[model samples]
Target: MTTVELPADAMDPTRDDRKSAKIAAGRVRPEPGAREVGGFGLGREVLRSGQMLQAGVSGDRFSPEDRFCPVFFLDGERHKKARTAIARYFTPKAINTHHRLVMERTTERLLGRLRATGTARLDELSYELAVAVAAEIIGLTGSDQATMAGRIEASLFATRVGSRNKAVRFGVGLVSALHAGRFYLRDVRPAIRARRAERRDDVISHLIDESYPDRAILVECMTYAVAGMVTTREFIVMAAWHLFEDDALRARFVAADAADQTAILEEILRLEPVAAMLHRRAERDVAFTGAVAAAGDVLAINIRAANVDPAAVGACPHALDPDRGTKQKQVGSFLSFGDGSHRCPGAQVAMAESRIFLDGLFAVPGIRLERAPDLTWFDGLGSYELRHAVIACTPAPTAD
Candidate 1:
């Protein structure tokens, strides 16, 4: 191996690479400079731009009173305050203290089921594990986790019955609402009631203490539901697919330390972010580097393209390199989780849970991918979902 020395500062994050990395025959070198804008410079520009309000989930369409929505959509001080109050649940100390055991036990149970069944859908198992772990963190322990998982998944990812017919559209909307309502009633309300009587260190409890109405609390629950459960589940299937398909890479990942395993996972996420495009609307005209957005102009931050931008990511932006982000002193997942004020607060939580669960998953003896998942585009969140990923493992020996 040859060592390539890099300058102290690189890429001049403000100065555009202009796709130079893509044109430079799969490699581009970085030069030292004031490059605080590390991952996806333009994406960072809009994300950090004080002039932009989140447009995802129609946040910009909400009136001021209705802005008490998900932290993902809140702007300015409200966003900051909400983020602060809810910060405790996602902090490193809190995750370790409150969530680690749940993640471990959930992983074990899921793996045990996989072993006993000999064959199972990786996506299904991942969904259950993701829901179980996230529900625990959100204080959503009010109902059967599996039932709740099914409800939320049905609400979010159920096939969008694409029809231009007004009547058909109404039916689809009604079904979706019913799914959402069931989740709220069966999962969110119970948690809220329980937390009301006795506060706890969880997202639901915090929202209740803040005097969030039941409707707002339900919205918040749905937000965490999608953010925590859906995204994590997809990532697990994606990571497992990559590992099971590559013998050498799988070996490296399986034998790696916790930090190394996480890096590998982040690298994969960089290549395949669950939310490929994050929408933001400009509250005022803003300019950064080579781009500008006017007030009320909707900006689609292309996370997928940004992740591969050669200028920020540096050389072979397409290849998997666990060390590249770290070598450049960048977050391993880059802008995969997002950037700036609205950056996903649960990044550390997601990374920890994913690493823990996947480590156990791949460690199963004779575990092998039996069928690949069907890939489908989901416009609801601007991402992809993988389903029907079947894997087989040696059945656990029966107790005599």
Candidate 2:
């Protein structure tokens, strides 16, 4: 194994400098004269580089001539084309118009379940909500939502690319392929057929319109599913945990207007970014600010570090100040949703969904946090998830 020495604050992975769920926050601040580096300024530059390639199996597993990689990893003209086409659905107006109903309906269903049961795990509800909203936008609504979610997770768990269990991943390779087959057959093909017969204002329909083959479409459907559902669930739970523990913030969130409520959530996201690290491999030599990466070197941009960078967010970067975005020049969600061509297109969709769900959630009279969520880290995704966040309220009276 190789190691590089630097100041402890600059590279400690165990620093609990922030009490953010299970993982100790990362601080990759480069030491003076050290080639290894991280900061919002340099990180942003790295993301924007044309020489960068997505740095994981997901990117390198397939070639464009055979099958397209996930759109998030696409670069140059193809990437631009995909982003431009998908932009129609992610725009604020599109989310409010095409997706708001799905968001509201899903949130209402989860809250109704909690009201009836008197308690539920926050993560489960959030996962369901995330799945439904994302499925609707991606046009995976033809099959069972929960079943699709299970298939996606199961398929990923069977593959080395998405599985945390390194030992069993290849052993389960056949299982992963089978699960993927079932997913395509059960979830994807139906959507493709429906979209082909009559297009809808969704991603799959757009792909069909663009003549993407079935395998390519399935690749995209599954990619969007994981990106939208898995990560958003973690963010919702993490945000709720923070607000539930702080009465002032919860009250502020509930009382604030939509824009302000979103502002508050953005601050929470800034402090507890779900995806801690984003990797990129240098296609050629790259130089940014304080460092240089040679051709073929893989780089990891520490999102947590960049989000809390002193230069980007100003003094007290770690503090949860809702007004910090305006106080400084940082983006609303910080770098949590990422930046440049690879930036998350669903930022508004996530923010809008979170606000709608949380507003209804906090409004539950007598709602209480029964058990604090324990944190679990997903090594494959390089993210932390809150689990077993038990929330309860008085059950809706049994019908006579």
Predicted model with the maximum TM-score: 2
Candidate 2, residue 219: the lDDT equals 87
| Segments in model 2 whose C-alpha atoms lie over 4 Å from true places | 1-17, 25-36, 65-67, 159-169
Q: State the lDDT at 86 in candidate 1.
A: 81
Worst 10 residues of 1 by lDDT: 27-36
Q: Give the per-residue lDDT digits (tens) of candidate 1, residues 1-400.
A: 1212233244233332211122232221121111222348888788888888777554544564574666776789888888888888888898788789888998898899888889899999888888987888789987998888888878873345557789987888888889888988888888888999999878888877777899888877888888999999888898888788767667788999988999988988887778766777778888878876777777777676778878888876766667768886898888888888989988998899888988998889899898988877665565677889899989999889
Clashes of each: 5, 0
User: Compared with the true structure, what per-residue lDDT tens digits does model 2 show for residues 1-400?
Assistant: 1123334235443422244633544433222222333588888888888888766635667675443566776777888887898998899899877799999988999999999999999999999999999998999888988888888878776433544577766667777789999999999999999999989888999888878899989888888888899989988998888788777778788999998999989988988887777777788898877788898887777788888887897666666677778878667778888888888899899999999999999999789898989886766676776889999998899989
The best candidate in terms of lDDT? 2
Q: How well does model 1 score by local distance difference test? A: 0.77
lDDT of each: 0.77, 0.80
- The CA lDDT at 200 in model 1 is 81
